[model samples]
Target: MYAAAGANARACSRRGRSLILPLRPLAWPAVTIRLGHSHEADDVFLFHALTAGKVDTGDLQIEPVVLDFQGLNDKASRGELEATTLSVHAYAYARKHYRLLRSGWTFGEGRGPMIVAREAMTAETLAAASIAVGGVTSSAYLAMTLWNPRARTRVLPFDKVLPAVETGLVDAGLMVHEEEMALELTGLVCVHDLGEWWSGKTDGLPLPLGSVVVRRDVDEDVQRQLHKAVSESVHYALANRQEVVTAVRGTVGGLEADLADDFLGRYITDLSLDIGDRGQSAAEEFLRRGCETGIIPDSLPLEFAPSAAAEPSSSARDGARS
Candidate 1:
């Protein structure tokens, strides 16, 4: 970020704003957060602020870094990024390589994976049968394993899943997140909702999707500042819906209002603040099972720092649900 026109102004580029919180002031080093399937609105608010200069660096400076939906966690592990959006599975995988700073995630009520067959779910399909799936840590894979522990699933990048499904390369593709409903246009039918299935298996609780994570090796104050600023930015972006829509179009390629609106509504958690007791517990149970089954190792901690979460804010009271 630079001062321009002798007016002391910052440039505005992406949809997100730079963290300019008043409470904590420091000329912090700029850091990058790789986002793939994070809340598009949050991404817009943040990316625009950091990259395009819409937001100022009052206490901290964050540089917006973009990565493919699949490469986010990988980049963080390689030290290519200090933070990134991660699926629970991706977080588990990355923990083996990097320190993790936990923040809010985009989980929702009853969202889950769909088998996504253009045709039909046949009983006999087995070896050599293909299925289009999202990248390594995507919720789709999480759903696949949870739904049927015995099945072996293949991991594919996000953009390629649709084309692969359309071409019949995979007999079926597993779809999750917002695409569970959106993929109907491509003749993709839902064989199951993994989140819903999980709910049935363990009562009513939102399925944990992906989260905003930072490297644990960073300074403690930096993490605290990030936690507060990011929380505020997301809340502020929700207040200015039009700005977020404009930012999404400008930064993330597609900017159609309907798509942007839907994306925002879906990924932006009304339960956006802290990981509630139930949510945290769910993470632990999931990790326990995932480790026991060899889906991931047990070294990962379900609670990154439970004591660090501050008291709940009134902002979420606006429309706090899932």
Candidate 2:
């Protein structure tokens, strides 16, 4: 009778174990997201908050894939990353694989890519001369071609473009990013400011340069989460500008605190946090013009990841309009 009682207890224990197993919560593994962006100061500043764990990313683990803008653009074209910063020109090709995020755009209101030469040249002469561009798919190149269809171009690494012009290998180099700010030091003269020209052409719409995009295959919920996280990151960076700038100064060699602040100020404005309707119109118009010029094979409808929080605040909208 004792043995029988023990057996009965063992059976009950087994049944209890089975019943308890079904009541336990499931633990899902964290998902790793590969975020591709350029190594420039502005890009570094925008992502510093998230990368440093200042923002709440929940289950998403962001892995930054840092590269030059062109390399990022190339990777975007191949659909190699979960998220990436792409030149507006390259987005035309990558739009099929990715949807642009509402945050993390670089728009030049009136100052942008400039054509620089060792010596001053007339617009007609510069248009007819050989120009070295960072990449054929760079927004600078597209704008250059649109501004002057007759200009000839050769592709070179962005850093090498200035050197190529200095050595007289190319009559001019289209300067973008920090290079655009270094013309005075390099003894190069600006032939044209593409942003200025674009503004004039588009009735003062800012020239969209770089934007972040997420792969379409990502779950909609995760996309929204990521967008919110990025927006938070931007806000964090802005709120703690001095701390973020000081942290990122080492990334770009010789980047003084003042210069870094100025650079970030130029690119990471309200639009970086949430690209408003005007910013959207500017991107659409840019791609539309690319299609009309036959530089881009075709344009895809711009699709943004859905996030209720992604809508621009009134201040952002007003700032974008300004």
Candidate 3:
């Protein structure tokens, strides 16, 4: 389903403003768009409406694919899914096949990924110790790289990281999502909060973690509709919080009710709807930092589908051509 015109559009309009369109709309039959998301609770909550037929998808039929963030990132890299949630770090590699949608983002303010150890560890010791990371391409790993470029890492499933550290397999682990809450029961101590480190480094900018990306080959109108649908879905989930939480139905696994509420509040609150100016700046800074550290090859320009109220920001427009 890749399109030459779409690739050209991506190259020509990296700023997220003008989209290169076909001379005329191509005639195509009804299609089912494969949408990918993580199994995490916030992801489940945000996407519940679309999966449950609570939102109008226009003419597109969405078939949901739920997996770990790393799994989704892998699929996105190969362009196997039409749409999916991906770590912003992974997006650096997958930007060729997909463009970020404006809605359905996960950003952290004062709180973010944590480096946890079974026993207290100092910054110097943690930097030299082996650590379990959920994914090599995850934002958590990216943050760790920036925080401690000398740290040694091993990739494990996000759920397995804590256990690996508990058993002394790794000296520490970088964790996010529900894993953040599980640290206490595992008797792990937080050595460093990457979000806090990032916040201080960037003057309190939110940590841009994950975002929804759509395949470039998809029609522009379909992409816009998808963004609108996701925005509405988040709004709906917030409005019917109880219903959405109930719908998740133990998806978070052993998380206490209070902790589940806290998790949702932290990840999906206001930033889930649209990744406004602050989020965009955070993303740009991440790219800049990642590039400076050689964690990623280069800081690619971000191209998000335009929202109703604005065009892409001036920074986006200025750097897109590069």
Candidate 4:
């Protein structure tokens, strides 16, 4: 899962210029991305555009090294990859280690996270058993803590959660990301959705989704370029989604094309790349509550970095599906 394509896509220079980037096949910077899962709109556009070579990585020569979003998050928090989509909870956790890239996005009010389990295991009957989750420090674990403070959740990678449960290694899973979609297919019924569970507890507001963050060490100019490139990619993906629905189908595997389209329509939203003001507020509120309940550390250093649209007319953004 760790593919560090070191120094291969290095920046190039041209005669009599500061550095004329060699962005072959692209007018913009050449980035080598280690893509995340298709469910995320953050990388959706970038993946689409990069594949189409519609936009360059940056003004100079940069390459994207996208990994699985979860894989990206793991590597990102450890300062491995440059940029990738992630959960807001992961963003909160990552801020302790990296600088946020920009206001990528969040799911609207109606779309929320769910904690599915085998039909037999109900929350009320949960015992002191292990709950498999993706990544020990992942948002799934965070949600599990929020859902049941007393639940014993064992953090594992996303791929391991379902298998762990199938083998009875854990009693439940606080799944997020692709697992949310794949959970039902596993034949291990869902017990709950922390997001749905959250809405019931917090009125109608949707559960906090995730965001995109980059390493603090990244060049500021490159960060800006990445922000622009990804934003446009998201915009384009949303506008021309009907086309890619088929291409993305094979990535998720075993899903009906129509169902994939429906999933994209439900999970992906207009604010796919910019969480803007409302997302920030919701994130802050989530952090406050999570901290208040002792679910997350009180001084976890979680913050909401302002976006380009922020400051001009600061107001809550409309809640849309992620």
Candidate 5:
């Protein structure tokens, strides 16, 4: 009798007769939201909960559009994605179409993109030499230009930047993402640390690297929902750090456990969970400098999505510590 009722119904006995009762609705039809992000470990760890169904997203069925940061930035420039991760530098151009989310921001407190070369060189020498950059629109590029506007740059894929440098295709490479970790192994030396330079320039303010933004045309209610969902996802991932780290390592090829852990420690901080006052200030200052240096075309006041009212749980707060 139970088998005959099928999976959607519950078997019950009524007056010694078999009765079939419909089961409660499991969930409402989910609204599909396309979220674009890089395929790096940090991004993978940040969204692990949402993509893996470890956290409730209400009615939202988040669809991950995995792309390189440059690709995601390009999509954001055209307002093609519902939500996307964008370089803070790219955000200067993309601000017309999207608003930043408080969560999902990566900041470098004392470290960031580096200019790596085959041999040690002075900043003055590096400024005049040809350098390979991950992307012209990337924050790293913006920082590089600001550090030395005369630096000759050629665009290459982020992953290819190192190889280009190794082969002497360029005098140095402006390295971002996990490529920084491979410096010693590749026999390259850091000529300049952009993040450290920026921090010193800004009087210790963090260097804004990347952030998630939502399309400006998205409904306010939906925007709020996305904000809440992403915030919760970050919190969930934080609360389950080890699990997320393990999962990210498995999914992102060549990402060893130690590397993943170190990357998360460097990036996924409280700032990653929410770009607080200092983070906002840092981003604004970074962009402002970009415009002043003529690297960025325009400057606009940074606008952020409304944050969820609920505070993070104790577990989340605890787990946020590196």
Candidate 6:
């Protein structure tokens, strides 16, 4: 769980504001929560405010660490980080150690991971083909398996998937992140958007791709404050779009300004601010499907921290009692 790193943090970038000094020193020391997020453009844009010290964290300080999405999921499983971004599939196993934050989640309406191939292949033919997948633990991989259990898979890094497909290393490739926007440059054709497929199955519910999780072991008050701080960061970014894009570009080199803006526009939405009733239902559906297909073992119940005014789950009530 997150604990105070020290009395003060190494000051953040000069571009943003610093923490406000307290009128008088408090008896308690300030806590610095270790935060882990992905290197994708959306995450970089969403987190710019928090990492740049633009949001007031109350008594808490957020120490940011950037890692690949798949690696963050793996680390979350081990409880290695106090707070981190994790794939929903990984969250299923770590439900005992973490509580899904109400905000900072990625859900898609009619867009998500794409299956790209050099040659046009219909969905019916894709069922029998071997494809390159980013990672076994990725939400994309889970979706691919659920979508086509019969297709064989070859694991490759996310960036390598498109190149592998272009070079004929695999029949087709599953691409996530910015690859969806760059597909045309590779001369590849998108066979299917998993998000659209999922929406069709669930009557237009957004696909719950990933979420932010805070260790359950932390004090409830501290966790709530940290959660609020995170939501504030996302709000700040939304209000300051150009700043977000510029700051994000400086951090994620080679990320075109336009692509970064496109990513922010796509991922950071109503769902990113708070997972409402609709998003909650979507999350449950994703987990239910995972369990039904045996991708995730049926063990812990899905118990996320609901929006402040939303109803709580019976499991959450039971957890509070114990």
TM-score of each: 0.73, 0.87, 0.84, 0.72, 0.86, 0.85
Model 6's alpha-carbon lDDT is 0.79
Distance from true location, Cα of 244 in model 6, Å: 0.7
State the TM-score for model 4.
0.72
Kindly list the per-residue Cα lDDT of model 4 for residues 279-311, writing each as its tens digit.
555566666777888766653445433334221
Could you tally the backbone clashes for each prediction? 19, 0, 0, 30, 0, 0
Consecutive 10-residue window with the lowest summed lDDT within model 1: 313-322
lDDT of 3 by residue, 131-225 (tens): 89878988888888998887888888767888999999999888875467666788888889999999999999988888999998776666766
**Of candidates 6 and 2, the better by TM-score:** 2
In model 6, where do residues sit more than 4 Å from their true spots? 1-25, 306-322
Per-residue lDDT over 1-322 for candidate 5, one digit per residue giving the tens place of the 0 to 100 score: 1233446566788889988665553333556789998888878888888888877776667999999888898899899998988899999889899999999888887899888999999757876889998789888888888888888888876678889999999999988855665676899999899999998999999888889999887755567778887888889888888888888878887766786788788877998888889999999899888898877877568988766555544353234321
User: What's the CA RMSD for each of the models?
Assistant: 11.7, 8.6, 12.0, 10.8, 7.7, 9.7
Tens digit per residue, CA lDDT, model 6, 28-55: 4566689999877778877888888899
Say which prediction, candidate 4 or candidate 6, comes out ahead on lDDT: 6
Candidate 1 C-alpha lDDT tens digits along 1-322: 2434443544455568663322323232444433333434445543443344444434455655555556675675565555566666666766744443344566656665567666666555632356667765665576577666766555676767777778877777777665643574687666556777777777887777766676665544555556665555555566666776677767655456777676667656655455667767666666666788777777456535222534433343222212
Give model 5's clash tally.
Answer: 0
Off by over 4 Å in 4: 1-46, 56-62, 101-103, 127-129, 298-322
Rank all candidate structures by their TM-score, best first, as comma-separated numbers: 2, 5, 6, 3, 1, 4
Least accurate 10 contiguous residues by lDDT in model 4: 313-322
Between candidates 1 and 2, the TM-score winner? 2
Model 2, residue pairs in steric clash: none
Off by over 4 Å in 1: 1-42, 45-57, 96-102, 122-129, 155-157, 178-182, 253-256, 303-322
The global C-alpha lDDT for each of the candidates, from Candidate 1 onward, is 0.59, 0.83, 0.81, 0.57, 0.82, 0.79
